[model samples]
Target chain A: MGSHAERKRRDGAQPSARVPSASPAAAHAHRESMPDGAAPAVPGLIRLQPSSVRAAAQTPLHLLPCEIQHNGPAAVSRFFSPAIRPGSSGPVVSFRGRSLHGEEVTLPSGYMGLVLREDKSEGPEDRTVQAIGTFSCFTLWGLEAPPGPNARMHRALSWPSLATAIHAPVAEEDD
Target chain B: MLSHKKRPAEVHCDQWVLVAPESVTDLPGKTENGPVFTRLHNPRTGEAALYLFDTNAQQLFEVKAFHEEFHSWFIGQTVQHDGRLLLVTPVDPLFMVLYYLIKAEKEQGKFQPLDQVVIDAEFPSCSMLLQCAKLRPFLHHVTEEKEIGNKKFYKYSKEKTLKWLNKKVGQTVRALKIGNVNVGARVSSATFVPGDHGSDVKEEDYICYAHGLISEYIPKELSADLAKYLKLPELSASLPEPPLKKRKVSDGPVEAEEDYTKFNRVDLKTKKTNSKMTAAQKALARVDKSGMRSISTFFGTKAKAGK
Candidate 1:
């Protein structure tokens, strides 16, 4: 009987082992004897460490496959060209912002673009968004939304049309 | 005595022409000076030349052009003409349009191009140059609208605001030099406070909370050590233990019932009916008694043979 009781205690002491008790009172007593925050003697509950929660939440999101090649303040300007406007002879797209010297530029066809400028804010709620630039009929190249906290900009461009135009296939398909 | 030496004709390209000034000058000539016009050519292709003219002779004459590889740093950006190096200035498109109009008038003999004009002599830094290029088009667009409104009255669209957030987020994360233990972990979700249905009242008066996640699993102790090394404050408090409960098991009736189950009925039958049985029969009966004893032992009970 002494050996049997000792075996029971040994089995119960394992980290992965679970003890079956007839009464809640006995189970409660058993749990009190365990070290603080240890796994519950009962079967259902799991005690996850706080660090695990933080670690799980910090996982990085997948990055989209796209590259931004240009640099300089006017690097974005390459995407802009003369856009056609009704009853307008020259380039139609006009940039209206504080920094501009007030000029009107026409974009060539097949050029489409957009620009967004956000002011620094103490919080996300206090941030201001300004449409600093835009063009007509541009393609979005990547995912619709930003990937993570690090993704400060989201840009997309049309793919199939651009690809087809750049790489001519042996047989042309009907548009 | 006349010397028989011929000077090289100044290199000129369509749209851009380079002319050496009689003297050095500053950039962006004034309306009074007859600035030296030069021919500028693209080193590559060498196809078209830009016609370069300056109105401010004093500024233009004072500056010298030197040959430097034209780094097409920004598109549609114009720089000052160094002897070979182009020093681009932040020219307002409106100013350019006005300057072009005045030049047209001079061509028609209605006015004279400036002979000697003063210009701002400071050369802009690279960043400043980039800023100028970025802001130029927007200013020109606003001017063309001819709207007489307050300069401070600006409206931001939802799309524009989100785009700004995206850029700022990227910039902040890239700028942060987190320690080695958290290298693969990145900022996952960032929330900004004072957000009104996705709009901000003021840019500066916002609070940003960024959460980062670990990509790989590490031992809990190691992870804790890393967090301690990085000096991250704990966000949650440890919980206290729950109270214990006691149970009372009765000893009288329960003990009697348990003993009754421990006895073997076969042993009682043999004791009552087999007083004169043969040795074989006794041995067989003993085997049956032993089987009952084993069953009782397996359940952690002492076996009782008779009633």
Candidate 2:
């Protein structure tokens, strides 16, 4: 996977659609034409668009137990919404002849979860993580019973906290 | 130097729900230094996943996604039918530095400056790890460093690395106690196998869980070594981890697209595989496969993609 494309980037420039090349504008050709220079593009960087970051808010989300293998529109209200029922332990949502148990999982403290949309005009090499929405918690659904601490995601949600300790700066006093 | 460039054949779009530190929002004015998200090889797995470098803060964070089937987001204006919840957390830069030092030991068998040793033609952004201020003080934990004329050259030391990993496991165990993590629950990921967790929790379970967590950052061989060093009794049989190796091949470092001509080509080739998909498959792909990252990443240890 790392063949010729490696060389293309090292050369400092490649013919790509993202470059403002269509205008045939020369480097520094128009300081008068534009006051601020285009942000120097960092190759392979995706940034959070500042304006979009401001738009982040609490968004409702669900994590289904089965893989959908798709990416576009869906009739969630018709097929999925009316199926959620309160069970003894937690919420149970039925779909495809299966009962899915749901539990709420929250992001670790000081971290915000945002639904990001790529600003379409930004090129692949350098793009921005434009936040369309945000969420603090989501329903994590699993088969049979809601996922306990042992569930893949339940354990995954514990990672950031564990990582903090594993990666924390070691105290100098340890012998 | 600004000359005309050619158009890329197609565009790449990524839309995932991301978790980031609050400070990342401060990135608008400072364009020069990025809160840049790039790809780096997962130190343990040698696979590439998206990593974020907030050079402005001189901090490094790793981004991983949590996805399950049939998940979707309901944002303010629309229903984002994607299945990924990306989590970004600060990662110790030393974990990555240790990767290079070990590789350097195998290749050159001698001391070399960090710049020379950490260079990767594929993941050029790996050099950005050097900007992490913690690298200098922490380098000695896993390497033997010699200073000459103000430049430090480093050689790998497994003994020290194991010692450092031991401390990591110890601290992770401590965090587990403080967090009151359900220590007796069955654990997944790392080299450890699934064992019954219904019994009472023991001190060893915490240690085992901690070691499994730390293993996510180091190589499997080194993980075996660390387990031995920690005197962790062999717990269970390790299974064939096919997804990580496959991920390594497909998810090349962020900069290392196999062929640029595929993007730079004048004439675009469009695959009509979508048209052939059954309606259910097509609709499902649209509703379910919204995560920009691969499904393999859903399991968090994809940081190691093992266990």
> How do the residues A1-175 of candidate 2 rate in per-residue lDDT, one tens digit apiece?
2223343353224222122222232211211111112433444456666666655666667776543323334566666667788988788977666687988888777766777765635434345657777777777777666876556665556657766777787655565
lDDT of 2 by residue, B106-142 (tens): 9999999989999987677788899897777888889
Q: What are the TM-scores, per candidate, against the unseen true structure?
A: 0.13, 0.66
lDDT of 1 by residue, A4-85 (tens): 2343344234312111211223111211112223322221111111221122211111111121111212223333333222
lDDT computed for candidate 2: 0.58
Worst ten-residue run, lDDT, model 2 chain A? A27-36
Model 2 misplaced regions, further than 4 Å: A1-42, A64-105, A139-153, B1-13, B25-34, B55-57, B182-199, B235-307
Write the residue-wise lDDT of candidate 1 on B1-307 in tens digits. 2221211111111111111221212212232232222222111111111222333211211111112111111123211111121111111222222222223334442322221111112211111222223233332221222233422222212233233223332332332222101111111212211111223322211111111111001122322333343334541210000000000132121221111111122323443453443222222222222111111111111111111
